[model samples]
Target: MAQNKLAPIETSFSKLMGVQYPIIAAPMFLVSNEDLVVAASEAGGVGTFPSLNYRPPEKFKEALTNIKSRTKKPIGVNIIVNKSNTRQEGDLKIALDAGVELFITSLGNPKSVIQDAHKNGAKVVCDVTNLEFAKKVQDLGADGVIAVGAGAGGHAGPISPLVLIPWLKSELQIPIIAAGGISHGGQIAACLALGASAVSVGTRFIASKEAGVDIAYKQAVVSSTPEDIVMTTRVSGTPAAVINTDYVKKLGTDLPWLLKSLKDNPMTKKYVVPLIHLMGMKALEKSATNPSWKTVWSAGQSVGLVDDILETAEIYRRLVNEYHEAKQSLP
Candidate 1:
């Protein structure tokens, strides 16, 4: 695919983000890296990686510099805005200074982040699971909202995109990026028709060549179906969608009362929750790096639609073609 080719589908979000396609390679934790981000941007969509992917502030700035050197296309960074993210402010400062123009805030209130981002001449988009949160972010001056509905990979929402996207569009003036159970061009077209300004794709990108996941994980995504996906709260304090490996299956779906209390109670959370979150992080890290399929593998219900591992550029091309074809087939 030609890097300069304009996408057949266009939207205000695409224009605002300076991308050809109204698509964002959702900032998948650990999985999204500089290579994937560059590939997605070069392929006409925006790409983002989690801020925590780079540990030290300096390292994160270095990665941002590298991404800037590679492509002029727009890219984004995801920040976990909750109390647990002790490095949030520092990371945001580094990214803003490094000229990152788009910030995606998740897992907490984005009001402060939105203010800072706007001050830096950047845009803030918040990941929201429900209408109330979506409206909250919009009121805070968010540039957009990503509706992370049920069936999305990683920490997913309980609502379905079928219901969430249109409702958010009807209620909010900001652009709605529909996420969940979207993999094919037909699904992208459907989302666009549903009043979404763009679509956020996660699981589908795991199979892309530029994704940093293990080859085994990519193959698992290709071979598995929606049945292989399960929701487990064991990986983190919150519910997350992960592949059902034997190891994952052995873990409980809910935390114990004590752990749950520590995770939820503000007073206890400061001391206890971080330790629990650390243990969970270690387990996930081991699973993602080790050779065993028994380890935790994250994927969404869209895994059923993924049939092959292809380059990120190729994936974008196919999606564009598929979207056009689907549109033509529509009555």
Candidate 2:
């Protein structure tokens, strides 16, 4: 189906993905479900979800089947190609056999994934934090690179999109897809102007109707300001941006000094994030009454831009409308 209320936004990335809009509803963990992916594709944008969201391996294929049955549009899946995720190869095999259109690789070398995906006529884009990694993936034959910046939700990079997007665009021949702190159409417009092929939006959609999180989680995304978002490596040992609820404030505080303390204490150093989850997040989530203090949720700095909950299709509609308005307003 096409976007009926607005004209299509064409870009090299959108054309490659066969989506009408120059947006990729970024693959999110825990929040993205089949409903969200289908809605995004039907709304004229590429929709994607993390393969890790499906557990027990069998369910992953079931998810792919469900999404494919619902929509014929091109869709994507996120795969963590790192050492910690032992299931990477298995997930990659299932995704390839399912004829997944695109693969978004993160954390580790995507060399093998790019080769296999391309052999199956699928495309691969790597999530790169810096120019060194981006250039390496391009040389490995990745179809594109997603420039993840500091303001991104999970394992965010050190650079800003303002620097990363243009830097990758100038240095790499492959398309550069900008990610981090992008929620609104104007922000998307700014990325395009900065030489991004398209913008991969993650956080804003967490509040959408199709996201399968608790209503309280969605509400947190809506009500929180940018100041409520903070970056800490405490939860997962990776620098990730998250909503700073009372629980995180109390436990995940002043991460640098705490990290220093943990590193010196060999007994606690190995335990770090997992030990904290066992001590804090798990306990609060199971027994707490205050919704804000119960669960730690991931969100980008764009939480400030997300003010309301809407269906995924509605979110795409409003974004396209806003993109046009922003473009027209520019001199």
Candidate 3:
């Protein structure tokens, strides 16, 4: 193992979260699991897994136990706060009861999540796309906000981190974890210099050895570039960055307004909308778990920077060294 000789990057975020490094492995929907989360935490950076990764509440608790048994490092759980997840509250309770100290909320207003997490002595970070939402989450008592900028994978925002990070910093007092388009250490350094407390990375970790994805999926990330990434709304009625596979291309960038309207209708939102979203998620899951990459494959523009599959620890070490080098290069 390469020795990480760089000075540690610490901020209020790291101190509050109890992590040695300011980097965090973003909690991907299906790609992040116990192994990935544990590996990341053990590597000195925090790791997070989506709550929906486990089906029942008991299973989620079991996974948390498994991670705790492996390492004493801090681990977080990502919860979708939207109505789409019927078991959101139950899942949150399970994570809290299992002693998770960090919670990352996505998709909807995190006011309730913030209240509940704080009540249980846990910190809540909400994902935001713009300044308005950032302030809203801050007002709701979020410990931090993850700025999901453009070129990120899976339901990304339209702004760049270069613009979003400083903007949020100027407007909000809470810590900002810049997400999207960050793969290399140079990018991480840039985000930190822009006043972000930390950086949230997802796509780069998809190619890590501990990722819960198939070999083909990892190789796709290694072989892909930014040009291969496309933003399409056909996937879940929301724009998300994904690899431009043949299957994805067939779906096109836009669905007909009539079909979109039907999917978005309030009357059918409970059933039809979820069904459509599930179909897209299932396709991506099949491609990730199976041996083939012919189905939907999600990736960020940062895929271009991922050229090989390495262990999570090695990835962290490389980031540390690169961050040091980049910092030294600046005048």
Candidate 4:
């Protein structure tokens, strides 16, 4: 583990979360799976997966069980509150039954989620893009808030981390976890210095070996630079940062094309080139070899910093090393 010379990370998140590191794997939609979550937890960081990743309730329970059996460390489950495809009550029930340590809810009002999570003795962390929502969640009794500012992977905020974290700290009294174009430890240190309790990373983890994405997607992340990313509003009605793939480029002018892409590959299994043009469901009917070979994967602007496909443990170690060194360099 890398030594942290930045401000002492002695907050509720670090204390009760009980992980050696103060980082949390941003719960990616289909890319974060049981294996990925488990690997990250064991590596000393909180690993998260979206509850909607599992189609049926039974499959969701099974995934929870597998993750628990694989690692004893704390694990987080993300719930998309405003998403159309989710069965919120049922998914929350399953997560509580499975004994998850943290519940990160986004895209909707988090009051109900906080109540349910508190009932189950689990912590509730809500994703907020602005101080208004941050105050709402804090007043409603959220344990923590994930500040999804500019450069964030999925649905993101227009605000910069330099502005958002400090603003939220002034308005709210709860723990704040900063998210966005944070690819290296220096960014993590910067977040802490700006009053964040911890850091939430998505794109960086997506490049790790434990991430359940395809090789092509991994390559896109490795090969990309900050200039290759674009902020688009076509995915789910919110501004989302994604790799400027041809598919996304087409989405700039065509809705039918995007819908066809989703219906074709509902799960978005990987960022392979073949998957880029192939429909997900149609490809499932075909062989994996032919499908994965051709997909253009999605990643954030931070993908430009990824140089290799490393194990989650190695990534965690590198982050700690960088964080410690960055902290030292600060003073």
Candidate 5:
């Protein structure tokens, strides 16, 4: 594949991923499907899908095949390394066998995956929320580290990018893709100036036309404010930003009570347990009525800046223009 080049960002991220932009769409759970991945790739940005999104290994392979058939641009698959899921090795094998161009690992030692990816001529990118994790991933031979700073949608770093980037830049030699709280081109330029080679965006992309999120969820992303964000691990045992919906407020007032109520609720056994595979759909449906939007609709504080739901192409154009403008305005 020919290297697609960009000037606003100097790192070989675009070349490395064969995309025209350095933006990698965060591997949003449930929201990252073949359509979204194809759209983002077509728009010059890399799109990523969480491996677990496809429950069955065969389904994961099907997704890879579908994405490959859709676009020539680079696309990535995220192998989550959390305690809840240990399908990293199996997923990596599937992705590599499918000729996956890029691999992004989160929550685990990427050395094993990096080794295989490099052996297969694939690039490896790891997501890090703090300086320690950033240094850790870089040391593991990852091609780059995704600096997931504060305001990131899912499991995120609480520190500011202004502080994390310079710290990582001073210590790490690999390319750093700054993430979190980044929505506009100006923020992207700021991250680049601060030593980030590129940027990764999640919440902002969730509201895009290419995103696979429900319409009500998209609307929540578009109309949300920074203050409307609440970070909690009550839902998934990892800190994540979500809208301050009724469920959030309820959890705020009494999480234990809510959990107990859920355990006691008849719906838990009937719909939640029996129909576990449809949880994503049920979550989206409940989010519309859950009042807290927090039960399932996850976004970031950057939602305040995502006023309009545009096509992926328009989003890329806006980001590129803002990046140039910010660079020109720099003293």
Candidate 6:
């Protein structure tokens, strides 16, 4: 298939991925759907989705088929290679067989994914929050690393993008894509200037119309500000950024007392942590599709930058147009 022509501005990542935009519509769990993927790809950014979003597992293949039918541009799929996802291997096989062009991995070691994706002639990028794990993924053969910084929407690392981008750039040989706290073209330029090849933007897109999420979810993302976001381990065993609605504040930011004790116990933690992840994911999945389910919405500090729901295409237009203005304004 023919690749997208170069954008007015280009980077190593955009060129490597054959996209016009130096951006990846960060694979969001439950939020990225056919329409969103199609819109992002057509808008010249890398469109990605989490394979586990398709329940029954069979629906994963259907999603791949449907997305491919809509656009010939290769799309990305995220796989959770951790103990919590029992179907990781099956999902990888399905995506590879269907000719998935890229794989973005998170929440676990990506060694196996890198091997399989390479064999299939697809590139793999791993999410990294720290230098130690970032180096490990590089040695394991990730095509790039997405530096998911402290300000990211979901499960994020403690490092700030300002520090992490340059930190990883100096040590790792592969390209680094910055994530977290980035909602505008100026932010994108700042990341690129900070030694990143591109960016993986998530929270802002959640408010886009093509996102197959509840209207209430979209509205909440628009209405909420940076201060409204807080890190909580209650949603998952790992700390994740979430909207601090009255419901979330009432639920509290940590695990309930019993779950906490189980997670802390040496003998039980091994098993309990995965169970905690599964339970938390179930809650997010439920609350994302409906507003009445305790409203456990996840969004980054950048949520404050989102003011209105927009078509995915319109969002891209603003981003690309703003990018030019920002670039020109730079000294």
TM-score of each: 0.96, 0.90, 0.96, 0.85, 0.86, 0.96
Give the distance in Å from residue 204's predicted Cα in candidate 4 to where it truly belongs: 1.0
The RMSD of every model to the true structure, in order and in angstroms, is 1.5, 3.4, 1.5, 6.2, 5.5, 2.3
Q: Which candidate has the top score in TM-score?
A: 6
Question: Which ten-residue region of model 1 has the weakest summed lDDT?
Answer: 1-10
For model 2, the stretches where C-alpha displacement exceeds 4 angstroms are 254-292
Tell me how candidate 3 scores on lDDT: 0.87
- Once fitted onto the true fold, the runs of candidate 4 whose alpha carbons sit more than 4 angstroms away are 1-9, 253-296
Each model's backbone clash number? 0, 0, 0, 14, 5, 0
Collision pairs in model 1: none
Better of 5 and 6 by TM-score: 6
List runs of model 6 lying over 4 Å from the truth: 1-7
Candidate 4 lDDT, 101-144, residue by residue in tens = 99998878877789989998899999999988888899999998
Native-to-model Cα distance after best TM-score fit, residue 207 in candidate 4, in Å: 1.2
CA lDDT of each prediction against the hidden true structure: 0.87, 0.84, 0.87, 0.77, 0.78, 0.89
Best by lDDT: 6
Cα lDDT of model 5 by residue, 253-276, tens digit: 223555446545876633332233
User: How does model 1 score by TM-score?
Assistant: 0.96
- For candidate 1, what's the RMSD? 1.5
Worst 10 residues of 2 by lDDT: 281-290
164: Cα error in model 1, Å: 0.5
